[model samples]
Target: MQPTPLATSPMPDSEMLRLRQEFVDASWWLTLVYALISSALLPARAWLLGSWRLSDSIIFLFIAGYLLAFGQRRRLGGWWRDSPPVLVMMLGGSTGLLGNGLLGSGLMTLIFANTLVAVLFGRRVVWIAFLYTMGVVLLAAWLYASGRLPPRVSSDYSSSPLAWLMAISSGTLMSFLVLHFVSLYRQRVEALHERLRVQSEEIARLAHHDELTGLPSLRLARDRLRMACHQAERQRSKAALLFIDLDGFKRINDSAGHEAGDEVLRVVAARMVEAVRSVDTVARLGGDEFIVILSGVPDARTATEVAQKIVAAAAAPIPWQGCTLQIGASIGIALYPEHSDTPEDLLRRADSAMYSVKRGGKNGYALHEEPRTPGHTCQPC
Candidate 1:
């Protein structure tokens, strides 16, 4: 049998939300990383090619200001939702222009840009980014070929040491992003599986246990009763089934309202559980009706003593709304192999005995006995 679970807190809509948020925060650091490396390489590229512009310093300031303002923001919504894609595009476009177009080491930056965009946005936006980047590279190539743009001091910049450095740095950034995202994705999947497992167990618990008092429902009680009878038959020991009906419960509901009645039932259920032995089973069959199964009882006398305890426990006044609410228990007992060996027959006999107690008087226990006449009838409670 599965153990009872404590109350569970509400689950988030999707476990992936946490991973996405982490990805957002990480994207900022990634952009800052690219900014630092690319900014450091700017002076080397200018000295190697002997072409530097005022726009280079302006772009560096823009990258720094952008990172300082929004790099640490963890939220994924509002104005900054599209910031990652824009940042990647800026880095990719500028690198491709400064390096000798896509024919040189700038190709790696374009690839890294598309990769980041794909992860942050979806496939469709990545396509748009790719086209936009290709357009920028093509326009720069056309201007340089048409003699509109000035030629660099060194035409062999692609064969220089600076190209190798840029390639290694960009490759490192891409590898780190892929590995980190994969690790985070695995954690999100594990968390989702754990939530599903807990939900399945809670669903099974609700099926077999009463929601109100957290006691075993009729289904679980019946299964336990069958097990008890089978064990008693094998060992030649005895087991008792006590059918309990709460008396004066209707009067309490009628007078104090259902909330008070519910409180009273909770208190009574707790008391009955305390009154029984640890090996015994207490179940709530339905509204105001309960059952107790006792295994390894010596005889009817011992079963009667347990039933007496249940009666006294149920009879205790439950305080509700600054007033005492009185209720009582009417229990009927049927022993295994004495009344009947089968669980169904034992329960029927016990229920019959309980109705008999209701007919005679309320708030008492009775044992199953042979009816004196065939015309006996019971009224609806």
Candidate 2:
């Protein structure tokens, strides 16, 4: 599923840290490469160009900055949210400033475009553009006043030196004002986006995971199982659904506070995940109950093996709150079609068998079979 804007925002905290470390390690190597090439190349170009202007060097720096930022883009996100938008504004500003020195015409136009990009992008893309626009307009205007503007040629009376300078100078001043206004608008938009991003992340985390166990909740589990079942069916094979219930969960919760009970659940959830096949699915259906879906199981034997593995894993006493605590689970095994056809039906059969095991004797698994009732929970006819 396509993630919301916030979900796709900057890299996750863990990934961000890893990339930061990698960037630090790799940065020096890239610098050394650039240094080696520039030591040999930049001097030659500067000598041949006969003393390059600051703007000329600025262009090269802008390109290098873009490359550095772009290298991290894939890790961050490619669309809508990567890179500081302000930096882009600054980049455009630099381009226009450099253009003024090299191309010498339409410097005002370049600065204006920088403002446009800045105003358009907001926080993730703000101030950099604004700074460049301001720099070009004020500096260029000052330079023009000092006779830095190119002299106008008069073939027609319409072309006058005073008029040409005034018009270009006025245009630069006007664009700077426009850029200033754009900056304010962008700031407001950035604030709104930040608010939305926070809310989006909060909602996504709550929806996909259990509050107590920190495992995928039933809604998310259903989606995963649906996909796994589809794959198993395509291969004309089978999958196992194990309904897991902690044997004495209620007594532990009632005796030791809910906090201690929660820890047990967390411990059990972790073990369940560790016990299963890598292709299996583990989900919490709330309050001391869990489910495991094992894919590509060939028959009841395979399903039985998985259920036994989980029971073994759960039987290991979990270390919690600096004390070892005992836990046992009753599991129900239900194979696809052998138990029932649909996801819900399979889950119900597995659940029934789990209850049977829980009642007959705790800490064991019962293979699901048709209940002795017509249309009972839609068990196989």
Candidate 3:
């Protein structure tokens, strides 16, 4: 049979929502920067030439639209987030056709815009942006060669092959740097997520277990008992609750300090675990007090035998600090359906019986006996 798989906890909804908002904010700022830069440069270039070209007017219109979209960003969706780079590419292509085909600065902007698309989006978007840019460049080149597009007017650098080479090389270098940093940022985020996942698992484990003895804590033990009761009721089988208290734990703590007391507790916990079956649960209720849940118990005899084993195991001398230290356990056993049906009631009865053993004398075991009255509950002895 295949082993049962552990349940995986999902990322919290609040965390995912926060990340989405952060991305939206990042995209908003990026668009804002691009708009501010374009609004400043386009008007200046038109003024310098003493006339506004159709390409410059179109770019201004695109910038206005982008600003409007940003103003209502919360109302807009993914389209608003992706529109800036797409608009830049279109503006670059138009400017290239109006100026000097592949020789103009518009080609440089197109390259940069494509690089931004790759940085912000996925591989598919990168490919789409790349193909669009290439198509625009080729189409402008064709229009110029065929005498359909206007010749170079704003600048004479278009005639120089060295100028074209420098523009392409610089654009390529800038895009490479942008893409490299984006990759590094993604890797860092992934590493942080992995660390958080591991820490979450550890926090969950620590919450359910005792730090000192490495046993299930009282709350976890109570939950286990409740589950055991449900299972017994369903299967029509007996379950046992063993409440154990260390006889001289307080004296040990007082005489040997808390460190030695902790050591003794760890040793006793290990011994109690060894004395129980694989199906049984051994838990530390608190400070030297432990509980065991025995499932599928055949009869009271089995519980009694297990209680005797635990008492012996716990009473054995522990070797510590080059000397032998001794402690005793008083165990109380309560059977499901015989003493009480509920997990709470069973545990209470077992606790009462354990006190009876302590009162009678240390280092012994007791089975809880039901009260004579129909409604009266057994009190602690």
Candidate 4:
């Protein structure tokens, strides 16, 4: 049977929650924006064009301070908490520089560099920084062409159009390069994860299956018996358990080490598999012991035919230990309800019948269809 379904991934990982992390990482910047906005409008500075203003810078700083504090205290400590605040903080600050000030474009460039180094190139921050850089250039162009923004010295800056163009071209190129490498890294990581998942599933399957016989091992056979019994009870149908012991197997094992014995078992198992219907189960209980579970069997006839086929298959030459040694199986059949209802009970009854055959005579099968009553000679019904 195939394996059970895998559990879904818990919370699709840190990379999936893209926007959330950005905001948390940049929490400090909101306060700074407010300060800058407030101070820009304030009529306090008396330098350059007019009075220098401190209101916009102060307001931006205070708001940034509040956001940073909230993120660090309430969100940063927990593993599943929201982002670090700085990533988003820097993102927004860069967007503002797109149109904030013609002279501040260089400042935004420096911020982009810092964000790239902090979040690492393979993360979502790479794209965010690139777009912000493009915005900064776009805003600078608009302001420069519209004549709304003046340079450090208005009269002197107006003549340097070539310098401005060069800056825009170089910065846009740098941002594109960062985006290219980040995309490549993301693909590589995803491929590695998929490979690991497949290998894990393969290892788990190998652990439960017998390689040579293509049957369940001791651990898996026990589990399957329990599951089958539960299904039989639900359907109101009977289940039959058969324990098969190959006579003269020790002679084969001794003559041919384990490799030849294994080959004999594999060949025998293949024939037994064909003898039973696909709906039934054949499992390697261990060494020379095997189990066959017949589900929804209506009566003894169904069990008898399957046991007879197994007898014939074992009687055929199976190349035992490579010398073509003949092998025979002594089968013990025990029915559900007729013998025992539980998986353990059925196994015990089948095992007893098999031993009875081994001691009575080899190359034959037996079944315990009726319970022992008061006192009388019991015969096959």
Q: Pick the candidate with the highest TM-score.
A: 1
lDDT of 3 by residue, 269-356 (tens): 9998899888889999877789999988878888888888888887889887988778998888899988898899999999988887
Q: Which one wins by TM-score: 2 or 4?
A: 4
For 254-344, candidate 1 gives per-residue lDDT tens digits of 8888887788778988998998889889999988999999988878988888888988898888888788999988888899989897999
Q: How many backbone clashes does candidate 3 have?
A: 0
lDDT to native, each model: 0.76, 0.63, 0.73, 0.63
Per-residue lDDT value at 110 in model 3: 77
By lDDT, is 2 or 3 better? 3
The list of candidate 3 runs beyond 4 A from truth reads 1-164, 370-381
TM-scores for every candidate against the unseen true structure:
0.71, 0.51, 0.60, 0.57
* Span of ten consecutive residues with least summed lDDT in model 2: 372-381
State the lDDT of candidate 4 residue by residue for 294-342, as single tens digits.
8888887788789889988988986543368678898888988778867
Regions of model 1 farther than 4 Å from truth: 1-13, 51-118, 121-180, 370-381
Cα lDDT of model 2 by residue, 1-381, tens digit: 112243444435544344433433333233334323333443454564456656547646755765565556546543333333334334434444443442333354455445445434456545655565667667766765687664232233135443344335435444545654545446545655686688787779779987666678899988877776887889988878889998777877787767668778878888888888777889999887899988888888887777777787777887767877777888888888666788888889899888877666578677886322111232322
RMSD of 1: 6.7
Q: Which stretches of candidate 4 lie over 4 Å from their true place?
A: 1-105, 119-165, 319-325, 369-381
